[model samples]
Target: MIDSDILCDLILANKHKCKGGEVADYIPGLKNANRESFGVCLIDSNREVHCAGDYEEKFTIQSISKPLVLMLAILDNGEDFVFSKIGMEPTGDAFNSIQKLETSNLRKPFNPMINAGAIAVSSMISGASAEEKFNRVLDFIRKISENPTLDYDEEIYLGEKETGNRNRSMAYFMKNDGVIEGDVEEALDVYFRQCSIRVSAQDLARIGLFLANNGVTSSGERVVSEHTTRIVKSLMVTCGMYDGSGEFAVRVGIPAKSGVGGGILSLVPGRMGIGVYGPALDPKGNSIGGYAILEDLSKILSLSIF
Candidate 1:
Protein backbone atom coordinates (compact mmCIF):
# COMPACT_ATOMS: atom_id res chain seq x y z
CA MET A 1 0.00 0.00 0.00
CA ILE A 2 1.17 3.52 -0.74
CA ASP A 3 1.75 5.77 2.24
CA SER A 4 -1.35 7.80 3.11
CA ASP A 5 0.93 10.50 4.48
CA ILE A 6 2.53 11.15 1.08
CA LEU A 7 -0.83 11.53 -0.57
CA CYS A 8 -2.01 13.90 2.12
CA ASP A 9 1.06 16.06 1.77
CA LEU A 10 0.58 16.20 -2.01
CA ILE A 11 -2.96 17.49 -1.51
CA LEU A 12 -1.90 20.17 0.93
CA ALA A 13 0.97 21.21 -1.30
CA ASN A 14 -1.29 21.82 -4.30
CA LYS A 15 -4.56 22.87 -2.67
CA HIS A 16 -3.66 26.56 -2.93
CA LYS A 17 -3.23 26.25 -6.71
CA CYS A 18 -6.99 25.79 -7.00
CA LYS A 19 -7.42 29.51 -6.42
CA GLY A 20 -5.51 30.25 -9.62
CA GLY A 21 -7.61 28.03 -11.87
CA GLU A 22 -11.24 28.01 -12.96
CA VAL A 23 -13.86 25.30 -12.92
CA ALA A 24 -15.41 24.32 -16.27
CA ASP A 25 -18.10 26.99 -16.65
CA TYR A 26 -19.59 26.09 -20.00
CA ILE A 27 -21.23 22.94 -18.69
CA PRO A 28 -24.05 24.19 -16.47
CA GLY A 29 -23.85 21.23 -14.10
CA LEU A 30 -20.08 21.21 -14.03
CA LYS A 31 -20.05 24.84 -12.92
CA ASN A 32 -21.63 23.68 -9.65
CA ALA A 33 -18.53 21.73 -8.64
CA ASN A 34 -16.61 22.88 -5.57
CA ARG A 35 -13.46 24.59 -6.87
CA GLU A 36 -11.47 23.81 -3.73
CA SER A 37 -11.97 20.05 -4.00
CA PHE A 38 -8.87 17.92 -4.74
CA GLY A 39 -8.21 14.23 -4.39
CA VAL A 40 -6.05 11.28 -5.52
CA CYS A 41 -6.36 7.50 -5.54
CA LEU A 42 -3.63 5.02 -6.46
CA ILE A 43 -4.11 1.32 -7.10
CA ASP A 44 -1.25 -1.08 -7.53
CA SER A 45 -1.15 -4.29 -9.54
CA ASN A 46 -1.75 -6.12 -6.29
CA ARG A 47 -5.16 -4.45 -6.04
CA GLU A 48 -4.09 -2.28 -3.13
CA VAL A 49 -5.76 1.14 -2.96
CA HIS A 50 -4.10 4.27 -1.55
CA CYS A 51 -6.13 7.42 -1.48
CA ALA A 52 -6.41 10.83 0.14
CA GLY A 53 -8.73 13.83 0.44
CA ASP A 54 -12.06 13.58 -1.40
CA TYR A 55 -11.19 10.47 -3.37
CA GLU A 56 -14.72 9.18 -3.08
CA GLU A 57 -16.33 12.31 -4.55
CA LYS A 58 -18.22 11.36 -7.67
CA PHE A 59 -17.97 13.43 -10.87
CA THR A 60 -18.75 12.99 -14.55
CA ILE A 61 -16.15 11.09 -16.53
CA GLN A 62 -16.06 13.69 -19.32
CA SER A 63 -13.42 13.22 -22.09
CA ILE A 64 -11.61 10.56 -20.05
CA SER A 65 -14.24 8.18 -21.44
CA LYS A 66 -12.85 8.59 -24.96
CA PRO A 67 -10.03 6.05 -24.62
CA LEU A 68 -12.36 3.40 -23.21
CA VAL A 69 -14.96 3.96 -25.95
CA LEU A 70 -12.22 3.75 -28.57
CA MET A 71 -11.23 0.38 -27.09
CA LEU A 72 -14.79 -0.95 -27.43
CA ALA A 73 -15.10 0.43 -30.98
CA ILE A 74 -11.92 -1.39 -31.98
CA LEU A 75 -13.18 -4.60 -30.35
CA ASP A 76 -16.48 -4.37 -32.23
CA ASN A 77 -14.88 -3.35 -35.50
CA GLY A 78 -11.19 -3.69 -36.29
CA GLU A 79 -8.15 -1.41 -36.30
CA ASP A 80 -8.43 -0.85 -40.03
CA PHE A 81 -12.10 0.11 -39.81
CA VAL A 82 -11.62 2.36 -36.77
CA PHE A 83 -8.36 4.01 -37.86
CA SER A 84 -9.77 4.41 -41.38
CA LYS A 85 -12.29 6.79 -39.83
CA ILE A 86 -10.10 8.48 -37.16
CA GLY A 87 -6.42 9.38 -37.40
CA MET A 88 -4.05 8.47 -34.51
CA GLU A 89 -2.09 11.74 -34.44
CA PRO A 90 -2.63 14.50 -31.87
CA THR A 91 -4.11 17.88 -32.79
CA GLY A 92 -2.60 21.16 -31.60
CA ASP A 93 -6.09 22.68 -31.59
CA ALA A 94 -8.64 22.44 -28.78
CA PHE A 95 -10.43 19.11 -28.25
CA ASN A 96 -13.65 20.55 -29.64
CA SER A 97 -12.12 22.52 -32.53
CA ILE A 98 -13.70 22.21 -35.98
CA GLN A 99 -10.94 23.94 -37.95
CA LYS A 100 -8.94 20.71 -38.44
CA LEU A 101 -11.96 18.75 -39.68
CA GLU A 102 -12.61 21.31 -42.41
CA THR A 103 -8.92 21.37 -43.43
CA SER A 104 -7.98 17.67 -43.38
CA ASN A 105 -7.58 16.11 -46.83
CA LEU A 106 -8.59 12.69 -45.51
CA ARG A 107 -11.64 14.28 -43.87
CA LYS A 108 -11.06 12.35 -40.61
CA PRO A 109 -10.57 13.85 -37.14
CA PHE A 110 -6.91 13.94 -36.00
CA ASN A 111 -7.44 11.47 -33.13
CA PRO A 112 -10.13 9.61 -31.18
CA MET A 113 -9.50 11.68 -28.04
CA ILE A 114 -11.05 14.73 -29.68
CA ASN A 115 -14.83 15.26 -29.74
CA ALA A 116 -15.06 14.72 -33.49
CA GLY A 117 -13.12 11.46 -33.50
CA ALA A 118 -14.91 10.16 -30.40
CA ILE A 119 -18.29 10.87 -32.04
CA ALA A 120 -17.09 9.05 -35.15
CA VAL A 121 -16.03 6.09 -33.01
CA SER A 122 -19.30 6.10 -31.03
CA SER A 123 -21.14 5.73 -34.33
CA MET A 124 -19.18 2.55 -35.01
CA ILE A 125 -20.20 0.75 -31.79
CA SER A 126 -22.31 -2.26 -32.81
CA GLY A 127 -25.89 -2.38 -31.59
CA ALA A 128 -29.42 -2.41 -32.98
CA SER A 129 -30.35 0.72 -31.01
CA ALA A 130 -28.56 3.64 -29.35
CA GLU A 131 -29.58 2.37 -25.92
CA GLU A 132 -28.05 -1.02 -26.62
CA LYS A 133 -24.88 0.64 -27.82
CA PHE A 134 -24.63 2.88 -24.75
CA ASN A 135 -25.33 -0.01 -22.39
CA ARG A 136 -22.59 -2.02 -24.01
CA VAL A 137 -20.07 0.76 -23.41
CA LEU A 138 -21.36 1.28 -19.88
CA ASP A 139 -21.09 -2.42 -19.12
CA PHE A 140 -17.56 -2.47 -20.38
CA ILE A 141 -16.65 0.37 -18.02
CA ARG A 142 -18.32 -1.40 -15.11
CA LYS A 143 -16.59 -4.73 -15.72
CA ILE A 144 -13.13 -3.21 -16.08
CA SER A 145 -13.49 -1.08 -12.98
CA GLU A 146 -15.27 -3.78 -10.98
CA ASN A 147 -17.98 -1.26 -10.18
CA PRO A 148 -21.34 -2.83 -10.86
CA THR A 149 -23.31 0.22 -9.71
CA LEU A 150 -21.61 2.71 -12.04
CA ASP A 151 -24.12 4.84 -13.92
CA TYR A 152 -24.40 8.12 -15.81
CA ASP A 153 -25.44 11.35 -14.12
CA GLU A 154 -28.80 12.48 -15.52
CA GLU A 155 -28.20 16.12 -14.69
CA ILE A 156 -24.80 16.05 -16.35
CA TYR A 157 -26.24 14.31 -19.40
CA LEU A 158 -28.98 16.93 -19.70
CA GLY A 159 -26.49 19.73 -19.34
CA GLU A 160 -24.32 18.26 -22.09
CA LYS A 161 -27.29 17.77 -24.39
CA GLU A 162 -28.57 21.28 -23.74
CA THR A 163 -25.26 23.10 -24.30
CA GLY A 164 -23.65 20.74 -26.80
CA ASN A 165 -24.18 22.85 -29.91
CA ARG A 166 -20.46 22.80 -30.69
CA ASN A 167 -20.35 19.01 -30.49
CA ARG A 168 -23.44 18.80 -32.72
CA SER A 169 -21.69 20.99 -35.25
CA MET A 170 -18.70 18.60 -35.23
CA ALA A 171 -20.91 15.52 -35.66
CA TYR A 172 -22.84 17.12 -38.52
CA PHE A 173 -19.60 18.14 -40.23
CA MET A 174 -18.20 14.61 -39.93
CA LYS A 175 -21.47 13.16 -41.22
CA ASN A 176 -21.41 15.44 -44.27
CA ASP A 177 -17.84 14.38 -45.02
CA GLY A 178 -18.88 10.69 -44.81
CA VAL A 179 -16.56 10.10 -41.85
CA ILE A 180 -19.49 8.98 -39.69
CA GLU A 181 -22.55 7.09 -40.99
CA GLY A 182 -26.17 6.54 -39.88
CA ASP A 183 -28.08 8.63 -37.34
CA VAL A 184 -25.68 11.36 -36.28
CA GLU A 185 -27.89 12.20 -33.33
CA GLU A 186 -27.70 8.63 -32.07
CA ALA A 187 -23.91 8.77 -32.23
CA LEU A 188 -23.88 12.08 -30.36
CA ASP A 189 -26.12 10.59 -27.66
CA VAL A 190 -23.69 7.75 -27.10
CA TYR A 191 -20.80 10.20 -26.90
CA PHE A 192 -22.57 12.57 -24.54
CA ARG A 193 -23.82 9.77 -22.31
CA GLN A 194 -20.38 8.24 -22.05
CA CYS A 195 -18.95 11.59 -20.99
CA SER A 196 -21.67 11.98 -18.39
CA ILE A 197 -20.99 8.68 -16.69
CA ARG A 198 -20.22 9.33 -13.01
CA VAL A 199 -17.06 7.93 -11.36
CA SER A 200 -14.98 8.67 -8.31
CA ALA A 201 -11.20 8.98 -8.18
CA GLN A 202 -11.07 5.41 -6.87
CA ASP A 203 -13.14 4.22 -9.83
CA LEU A 204 -10.79 5.98 -12.21
CA ALA A 205 -7.82 4.37 -10.45
CA ARG A 206 -9.36 0.92 -10.81
CA ILE A 207 -9.89 1.54 -14.53
CA GLY A 208 -6.35 2.81 -14.82
CA LEU A 209 -5.06 -0.32 -13.11
CA PHE A 210 -6.99 -2.35 -15.67
CA LEU A 211 -5.10 -0.54 -18.41
CA ALA A 212 -1.83 -1.02 -16.51
CA ASN A 213 -2.56 -4.73 -16.56
CA ASN A 214 -3.12 -4.63 -20.32
CA GLY A 215 -6.92 -4.87 -20.17
CA VAL A 216 -7.06 -7.59 -17.56
CA THR A 217 -9.31 -7.09 -14.54
CA SER A 218 -8.20 -7.67 -10.96
CA SER A 219 -9.81 -11.12 -10.97
CA GLY A 220 -7.73 -12.16 -13.99
CA GLU A 221 -10.49 -11.75 -16.55
CA ARG A 222 -9.43 -10.24 -19.85
CA VAL A 223 -12.02 -7.62 -20.75
CA VAL A 224 -10.12 -6.55 -23.86
CA SER A 225 -7.23 -7.89 -25.88
CA GLU A 226 -3.68 -6.77 -25.11
CA HIS A 227 -3.49 -5.28 -28.60
CA THR A 228 -6.52 -3.06 -27.97
CA THR A 229 -5.17 -1.75 -24.65
CA ARG A 230 -1.89 -0.83 -26.32
CA ILE A 231 -3.67 1.29 -28.91
CA VAL A 232 -5.86 3.00 -26.28
CA LYS A 233 -2.90 3.72 -24.01
CA SER A 234 -0.91 5.09 -26.93
CA LEU A 235 -3.72 7.48 -27.72
CA MET A 236 -3.91 8.45 -24.05
CA VAL A 237 -0.21 9.33 -24.05
CA THR A 238 -0.33 11.29 -27.27
CA CYS A 239 -3.74 12.96 -27.31
CA GLY A 240 -5.32 12.57 -23.86
CA MET A 241 -4.61 16.04 -22.43
CA TYR A 242 -6.05 18.02 -25.31
CA ASP A 243 -3.31 20.41 -26.60
CA GLY A 244 -1.35 20.03 -23.36
CA SER A 245 -0.37 16.38 -23.87
CA GLY A 246 3.23 16.98 -24.90
CA GLU A 247 3.97 19.07 -21.84
CA PHE A 248 2.39 16.43 -19.58
CA ALA A 249 4.50 13.72 -21.20
CA VAL A 250 7.64 15.78 -20.66
CA ARG A 251 6.78 16.49 -17.02
CA VAL A 252 5.03 13.30 -15.85
CA GLY A 253 6.05 10.81 -18.55
CA ILE A 254 3.12 8.45 -18.13
CA PRO A 255 0.11 7.32 -20.13
CA ALA A 256 -2.73 9.52 -18.80
CA LYS A 257 -6.13 10.89 -19.80
CA SER A 258 -7.71 14.03 -18.26
CA GLY A 259 -11.39 15.01 -18.19
CA VAL A 260 -12.99 18.43 -18.02
CA GLY A 261 -14.45 17.33 -14.67
CA GLY A 262 -10.95 17.70 -13.29
CA GLY A 263 -10.00 14.03 -13.20
CA ILE A 264 -6.80 12.49 -14.54
CA LEU A 265 -6.35 8.74 -15.08
CA SER A 266 -2.75 7.64 -15.31
CA LEU A 267 -0.95 4.29 -15.37
CA VAL A 268 2.54 2.89 -15.07
CA PRO A 269 2.85 -0.30 -17.05
CA GLY A 270 3.02 -3.39 -14.80
CA ARG A 271 3.16 -1.24 -11.71
CA MET A 272 0.30 1.02 -10.65
CA GLY A 273 -2.62 3.25 -11.70
CA ILE A 274 -3.40 6.73 -10.41
CA GLY A 275 -6.48 8.98 -10.44
CA VAL A 276 -6.66 12.65 -9.40
CA TYR A 277 -9.53 15.15 -9.32
CA GLY A 278 -9.27 18.92 -8.91
CA PRO A 279 -12.12 20.89 -10.43
CA ALA A 280 -10.13 24.08 -10.90
CA LEU A 281 -8.62 24.00 -14.39
CA ASP A 282 -5.94 25.80 -16.31
CA PRO A 283 -6.73 27.55 -19.62
CA LYS A 284 -6.09 24.27 -21.46
CA GLY A 285 -8.67 22.46 -19.26
CA ASN A 286 -6.36 20.22 -17.21
CA SER A 287 -6.75 20.30 -13.40
CA ILE A 288 -4.08 22.59 -12.01
CA GLY A 289 -3.90 20.99 -8.55
CA GLY A 290 -4.28 17.49 -9.93
CA TYR A 291 -1.45 18.07 -12.39
CA ALA A 292 0.82 19.31 -9.63
CA ILE A 293 0.11 16.27 -7.46
CA LEU A 294 0.87 13.86 -10.31
CA GLU A 295 4.05 15.70 -11.26
CA ASP A 296 5.34 15.49 -7.70
CA LEU A 297 4.16 11.91 -7.29
CA SER A 298 5.92 10.87 -10.47
CA LYS A 299 9.17 12.47 -9.33
CA ILE A 300 9.00 11.14 -5.79
CA LEU A 301 8.02 7.64 -6.87
CA SER A 302 10.05 7.55 -10.08
CA LEU A 303 6.83 6.52 -11.82
CA SER A 304 7.68 7.91 -15.23
CA ILE A 305 7.38 5.34 -18.00
CA PHE A 306 10.48 6.78 -19.63
Candidate 2:
Protein backbone atom coordinates (compact mmCIF):
# COMPACT_ATOMS: atom_id res chain seq x y z
CA MET A 1 0.00 0.00 0.00
CA ILE A 2 1.15 3.55 -0.72
CA ASP A 3 1.98 5.37 2.52
CA SER A 4 -0.84 7.80 3.19
CA ASP A 5 1.47 10.23 4.99
CA ILE A 6 3.89 10.43 2.11
CA LEU A 7 1.14 10.99 -0.45
CA CYS A 8 -0.37 13.70 1.71
CA ASP A 9 3.03 15.32 2.24
CA LEU A 10 3.78 15.38 -1.45
CA ILE A 11 0.47 17.19 -2.01
CA LEU A 12 1.27 19.79 0.63
CA ALA A 13 4.78 20.37 -0.63
CA ASN A 14 3.56 20.91 -4.17
CA LYS A 15 0.51 22.93 -3.17
CA HIS A 16 2.26 26.30 -2.93
CA LYS A 17 3.98 25.98 -6.28
CA CYS A 18 0.61 25.29 -8.02
CA LYS A 19 -0.80 28.73 -7.23
CA GLY A 20 -1.68 30.49 -10.47
CA GLY A 21 -3.58 28.37 -12.93
CA GLU A 22 -6.83 29.75 -14.36
CA VAL A 23 -9.66 30.28 -11.91
CA ALA A 24 -13.19 29.83 -13.19
CA ASP A 25 -14.54 33.39 -13.56
CA TYR A 26 -17.50 33.28 -15.90
CA ILE A 27 -19.69 31.92 -13.13
CA PRO A 28 -20.33 34.57 -10.50
CA GLY A 29 -20.24 32.21 -7.51
CA LEU A 30 -17.23 30.26 -8.74
CA LYS A 31 -15.29 33.48 -9.29
CA ASN A 32 -15.21 34.14 -5.56
CA ALA A 33 -13.39 30.87 -4.73
CA ASN A 34 -10.00 31.02 -3.05
CA ARG A 35 -7.44 29.95 -5.64
CA GLU A 36 -5.05 28.75 -2.93
CA SER A 37 -7.50 26.22 -1.59
CA PHE A 38 -6.32 22.58 -1.88
CA GLY A 39 -7.34 19.13 -0.69
CA VAL A 40 -6.80 15.42 -1.37
CA CYS A 41 -8.47 12.23 -0.24
CA LEU A 42 -7.49 8.71 -1.20
CA ILE A 43 -9.53 5.53 -0.66
CA ASP A 44 -7.69 2.26 -0.94
CA SER A 45 -9.12 -1.03 -2.25
CA ASN A 46 -9.91 -2.10 1.28
CA ARG A 47 -11.95 1.08 1.85
CA GLU A 48 -9.39 2.67 4.20
CA VAL A 49 -9.13 6.40 3.52
CA HIS A 50 -6.35 8.94 3.84
CA CYS A 51 -6.61 12.70 3.76
CA ALA A 52 -4.55 15.86 3.45
CA GLY A 53 -4.76 19.59 2.84
CA ASP A 54 -8.40 20.71 2.53
CA TYR A 55 -9.66 17.17 1.97
CA GLU A 56 -12.38 17.54 4.57
CA GLU A 57 -13.94 20.50 2.80
CA LYS A 58 -16.87 20.11 0.41
CA PHE A 59 -17.23 21.54 -3.08
CA THR A 60 -19.57 21.22 -6.03
CA ILE A 61 -18.74 18.21 -8.21
CA GLN A 62 -19.50 20.12 -11.43
CA SER A 63 -18.54 18.10 -14.52
CA ILE A 64 -17.26 15.33 -12.29
CA SER A 65 -20.86 14.20 -11.90
CA LYS A 66 -21.31 13.72 -15.61
CA PRO A 67 -20.13 10.13 -15.63
CA LEU A 68 -22.40 9.15 -12.76
CA VAL A 69 -25.35 10.64 -14.58
CA LEU A 70 -24.27 8.93 -17.74
CA MET A 71 -24.26 5.67 -15.87
CA LEU A 72 -27.81 6.32 -14.68
CA ALA A 73 -28.94 7.19 -18.15
CA ILE A 74 -27.34 4.05 -19.49
CA LEU A 75 -28.82 1.81 -16.83
CA ASP A 76 -32.23 3.39 -17.18
CA ASN A 77 -32.36 3.54 -20.96
CA GLY A 78 -29.83 0.90 -22.06
CA GLU A 79 -26.61 1.46 -23.99
CA ASP A 80 -28.09 1.66 -27.48
CA PHE A 81 -30.69 4.20 -26.41
CA VAL A 82 -28.21 6.42 -24.52
CA PHE A 83 -25.60 6.13 -27.26
CA SER A 84 -28.11 7.49 -29.74
CA LYS A 85 -27.98 10.80 -27.92
CA ILE A 86 -24.22 10.81 -27.39
CA GLY A 87 -21.21 9.88 -29.51
CA MET A 88 -17.97 8.24 -28.44
CA GLU A 89 -15.68 10.71 -30.19
CA PRO A 90 -14.00 13.69 -28.61
CA THR A 91 -15.47 17.03 -29.66
CA GLY A 92 -12.17 18.90 -29.35
CA ASP A 93 -14.48 21.85 -28.89
CA ALA A 94 -15.13 23.83 -25.78
CA PHE A 95 -17.38 21.93 -23.40
CA ASN A 96 -20.11 24.56 -23.53
CA SER A 97 -19.74 25.46 -27.17
CA ILE A 98 -22.76 25.10 -29.45
CA GLN A 99 -20.55 24.93 -32.51
CA LYS A 100 -20.71 21.14 -32.61
CA LEU A 101 -24.47 21.21 -32.74
CA GLU A 102 -24.52 23.90 -35.41
CA THR A 103 -21.99 22.12 -37.59
CA SER A 104 -22.24 18.37 -37.02
CA ASN A 105 -25.01 16.39 -38.67
CA LEU A 106 -24.79 13.49 -36.22
CA ARG A 107 -26.71 15.41 -33.50
CA LYS A 108 -25.62 13.14 -30.65
CA PRO A 109 -23.84 15.30 -28.05
CA PHE A 110 -20.46 13.92 -29.20
CA ASN A 111 -19.77 12.35 -25.78
CA PRO A 112 -21.49 12.05 -22.41
CA MET A 113 -18.81 13.85 -20.38
CA ILE A 114 -19.29 17.22 -22.07
CA ASN A 115 -21.88 19.76 -20.89
CA ALA A 116 -24.05 19.32 -23.95
CA GLY A 117 -24.02 15.55 -23.73
CA ALA A 118 -24.61 15.56 -20.00
CA ILE A 119 -27.71 17.70 -20.45
CA ALA A 120 -28.99 15.28 -23.06
CA VAL A 121 -28.04 12.32 -20.91
CA SER A 122 -29.80 13.79 -17.92
CA SER A 123 -32.86 14.40 -20.04
CA MET A 124 -32.98 10.70 -20.80
CA ILE A 125 -33.34 9.64 -17.18
CA SER A 126 -36.66 7.84 -16.48
CA GLY A 127 -38.56 10.65 -14.79
CA ALA A 128 -41.56 12.68 -15.70
CA SER A 129 -40.63 15.90 -13.90
CA ALA A 130 -37.44 17.86 -13.40
CA GLU A 131 -37.60 17.37 -9.64
CA GLU A 132 -38.06 13.62 -10.05
CA LYS A 133 -35.17 13.53 -12.46
CA PHE A 134 -33.07 15.51 -10.02
CA ASN A 135 -33.92 13.02 -7.30
CA ARG A 136 -32.87 10.08 -9.43
CA VAL A 137 -29.52 11.71 -10.13
CA LEU A 138 -29.09 12.32 -6.43
CA ASP A 139 -30.03 8.73 -5.74
CA PHE A 140 -27.46 7.44 -8.16
CA ILE A 141 -24.77 9.67 -6.68
CA ARG A 142 -25.66 8.66 -3.15
CA LYS A 143 -25.58 4.99 -4.02
CA ILE A 144 -22.15 5.33 -5.58
CA SER A 145 -20.77 7.39 -2.73
CA GLU A 146 -22.41 5.06 -0.23
CA ASN A 147 -23.20 8.26 1.60
CA PRO A 148 -26.87 8.93 2.12
CA THR A 149 -26.00 12.51 3.00
CA LEU A 150 -24.79 13.43 -0.47
CA ASP A 151 -26.90 16.29 -1.85
CA TYR A 152 -27.31 19.21 -4.17
CA ASP A 153 -26.17 22.73 -3.34
CA GLU A 154 -29.05 24.92 -4.43
CA GLU A 155 -26.94 28.03 -4.05
CA ILE A 156 -24.59 26.68 -6.66
CA TYR A 157 -27.46 25.33 -8.76
CA LEU A 158 -29.24 28.65 -8.85
CA GLY A 159 -26.03 30.45 -9.71
CA GLU A 160 -25.26 27.95 -12.44
CA LYS A 161 -28.81 28.36 -13.73
CA GLU A 162 -28.38 32.10 -13.84
CA THR A 163 -25.13 31.91 -15.82
CA GLY A 164 -25.53 28.74 -17.87
CA ASN A 165 -26.52 30.24 -21.16
CA ARG A 166 -24.10 28.00 -22.98
CA ASN A 167 -25.73 24.89 -21.53
CA ARG A 168 -29.19 26.21 -22.25
CA SER A 169 -28.18 26.92 -25.81
CA MET A 170 -26.87 23.39 -26.25
CA ALA A 171 -29.95 21.84 -24.71
CA TYR A 172 -32.12 23.77 -27.09
CA PHE A 173 -30.04 22.51 -29.99
CA MET A 174 -30.23 18.93 -28.78
CA LYS A 175 -33.98 19.21 -28.44
CA ASN A 176 -34.35 20.57 -31.93
CA ASP A 177 -32.31 17.73 -33.37
CA GLY A 178 -34.68 15.27 -31.70
CA VAL A 179 -31.76 13.95 -29.72
CA ILE A 180 -32.85 15.19 -26.29
CA GLU A 181 -36.46 14.48 -25.36
CA GLY A 182 -38.84 16.38 -23.08
CA ASP A 183 -38.67 20.15 -22.44
CA VAL A 184 -35.28 21.74 -22.84
CA GLU A 185 -35.79 24.04 -19.86
CA GLU A 186 -36.75 21.11 -17.68
CA ALA A 187 -33.79 19.06 -18.84
CA LEU A 188 -31.38 21.91 -18.23
CA ASP A 189 -32.89 22.35 -14.79
CA VAL A 190 -32.22 18.72 -13.87
CA TYR A 191 -28.77 18.75 -15.44
CA PHE A 192 -27.66 21.84 -13.57
CA ARG A 193 -29.00 20.40 -10.36
CA GLN A 194 -26.74 17.36 -10.67
CA CYS A 195 -23.64 19.39 -11.55
CA SER A 196 -24.16 21.41 -8.40
CA ILE A 197 -24.23 18.39 -6.14
CA ARG A 198 -21.93 18.85 -3.15
CA VAL A 199 -19.17 16.33 -2.49
CA SER A 200 -16.37 16.20 0.04
CA ALA A 201 -13.14 14.36 -0.71
CA GLN A 202 -14.41 11.36 1.19
CA ASP A 203 -17.63 11.34 -0.75
CA LEU A 204 -15.75 11.56 -4.02
CA ALA A 205 -13.24 8.91 -3.02
CA ARG A 206 -16.08 6.54 -2.17
CA ILE A 207 -17.70 7.18 -5.51
CA GLY A 208 -14.38 6.45 -7.15
CA LEU A 209 -14.20 3.27 -5.10
CA PHE A 210 -17.56 2.28 -6.48
CA LEU A 211 -16.14 2.67 -9.94
CA ALA A 212 -12.88 1.00 -9.01
CA ASN A 213 -14.68 -2.05 -7.72
CA ASN A 214 -16.76 -2.35 -10.86
CA GLY A 215 -19.79 -0.50 -9.51
CA VAL A 216 -19.94 -2.48 -6.29
CA THR A 217 -18.89 -0.99 -2.99
CA SER A 218 -16.73 -2.91 -0.58
CA SER A 219 -19.89 -3.71 1.38
CA GLY A 220 -21.09 -5.97 -1.47
CA GLU A 221 -23.97 -3.79 -2.57
CA ARG A 222 -24.32 -3.26 -6.29
CA VAL A 223 -25.19 0.28 -7.27
CA VAL A 224 -24.89 0.04 -11.05
CA SER A 225 -24.33 -2.61 -13.67
CA GLU A 226 -20.80 -3.97 -14.07
CA HIS A 227 -21.22 -3.43 -17.82
CA THR A 228 -22.47 0.12 -17.35
CA THR A 229 -19.66 0.98 -14.98
CA ARG A 230 -17.08 -0.50 -17.32
CA ILE A 231 -18.38 1.54 -20.22
CA VAL A 232 -18.42 4.65 -18.05
CA LYS A 233 -14.85 4.04 -16.93
CA SER A 234 -13.79 3.55 -20.53
CA LEU A 235 -15.27 6.93 -21.39
CA MET A 236 -13.56 8.53 -18.40
CA VAL A 237 -10.20 7.26 -19.58
CA THR A 238 -10.77 8.40 -23.12
CA CYS A 239 -12.56 11.70 -22.56
CA GLY A 240 -13.39 12.53 -18.97
CA MET A 241 -10.96 15.44 -18.72
CA TYR A 242 -12.45 17.11 -21.78
CA ASP A 243 -9.87 18.45 -24.22
CA GLY A 244 -6.96 17.56 -21.95
CA SER A 245 -8.04 13.90 -21.78
CA GLY A 246 -5.52 12.46 -24.20
CA GLU A 247 -2.57 14.17 -22.62
CA PHE A 248 -3.90 13.24 -19.19
CA ALA A 249 -4.22 9.57 -20.15
CA VAL A 250 -0.68 9.64 -21.50
CA ARG A 251 0.70 11.23 -18.34
CA VAL A 252 -1.60 10.52 -15.40
CA GLY A 253 -2.94 7.27 -16.89
CA ILE A 254 -6.02 6.93 -14.75
CA PRO A 255 -9.72 7.02 -15.46
CA ALA A 256 -10.70 10.41 -14.07
CA LYS A 257 -12.93 13.42 -14.34
CA SER A 258 -12.15 17.08 -13.68
CA GLY A 259 -14.46 19.93 -12.86
CA VAL A 260 -14.39 23.71 -12.96
CA GLY A 261 -15.16 23.88 -9.26
CA GLY A 262 -11.61 22.67 -8.60
CA GLY A 263 -12.54 19.07 -7.94
CA ILE A 264 -11.27 15.86 -9.54
CA LEU A 265 -12.49 12.30 -9.00
CA SER A 266 -9.90 9.77 -10.20
CA LEU A 267 -9.46 6.03 -9.81
CA VAL A 268 -7.36 2.95 -10.38
CA PRO A 269 -9.77 0.09 -10.98
CA GLY A 270 -9.82 -2.60 -8.28
CA ARG A 271 -7.32 -0.61 -6.24
CA MET A 272 -8.43 2.87 -5.20
CA GLY A 273 -10.27 6.05 -5.87
CA ILE A 274 -9.11 9.59 -5.07
CA GLY A 275 -10.69 12.99 -4.85
CA VAL A 276 -8.95 16.35 -4.91
CA TYR A 277 -9.93 19.98 -4.65
CA GLY A 278 -8.03 23.09 -5.61
CA PRO A 279 -9.82 26.20 -6.73
CA ALA A 280 -7.07 27.24 -9.08
CA LEU A 281 -7.59 25.76 -12.54
CA ASP A 282 -5.58 25.08 -15.62
CA PRO A 283 -6.62 26.17 -19.14
CA LYS A 284 -8.74 23.02 -19.33
CA GLY A 285 -10.97 23.87 -16.35
CA ASN A 286 -9.33 21.08 -14.29
CA SER A 287 -7.92 21.96 -10.88
CA ILE A 288 -4.24 22.84 -11.18
CA GLY A 289 -3.29 21.41 -7.82
CA GLY A 290 -5.55 18.40 -8.13
CA TYR A 291 -4.15 17.49 -11.51
CA ALA A 292 -0.56 17.94 -10.34
CA ILE A 293 -1.03 15.83 -7.23
CA LEU A 294 -2.62 12.97 -9.21
CA GLU A 295 0.11 13.18 -11.79
CA ASP A 296 2.77 13.02 -9.09
CA LEU A 297 1.01 10.22 -7.24
CA SER A 298 0.47 8.15 -10.36
CA LYS A 299 4.15 8.39 -11.31
CA ILE A 300 5.72 8.03 -7.88
CA LEU A 301 3.52 5.10 -6.89
CA SER A 302 3.74 3.43 -10.32
CA LEU A 303 -0.03 3.31 -10.43
CA SER A 304 -0.72 4.19 -14.04
CA ILE A 305 -2.86 1.68 -15.91
CA PHE A 306 -0.92 2.26 -19.08
Q: Pick the candidate with the highest TM-score.
A: 1
Model 2 residue runs over 4 Å out of place are none
The per-residue C-alpha lDDT of model 2 at residue 286 equals 81
| Displacement of the residue 63 alpha carbon in candidate 1, Å | 0.2
Clashes of 2: 0
Estimate, for each residue in 130-244, the C-alpha lDDT of model 1 and write its tens digit: 8899999999999988999999999999889899999999999989989898799999999889999999999999999999999999889998899999999989999999999
Error of 2 at 89 (Å): 1.0
With a 3 Å backbone cut-off (N, CA, C), the pairs that clash in candidate 1 are: none
What would the per-residue lDDT of candidate 2 be over residues 6-25, giving only the tens digit for each residue?
A: 76787877788557786788
Candidate 2 is scored at a TM of 0.97
lDDT of each: 0.92, 0.86
Runs of candidate 1 with Cα error greater than 4 angstroms are none
lDDT of 2: 0.86
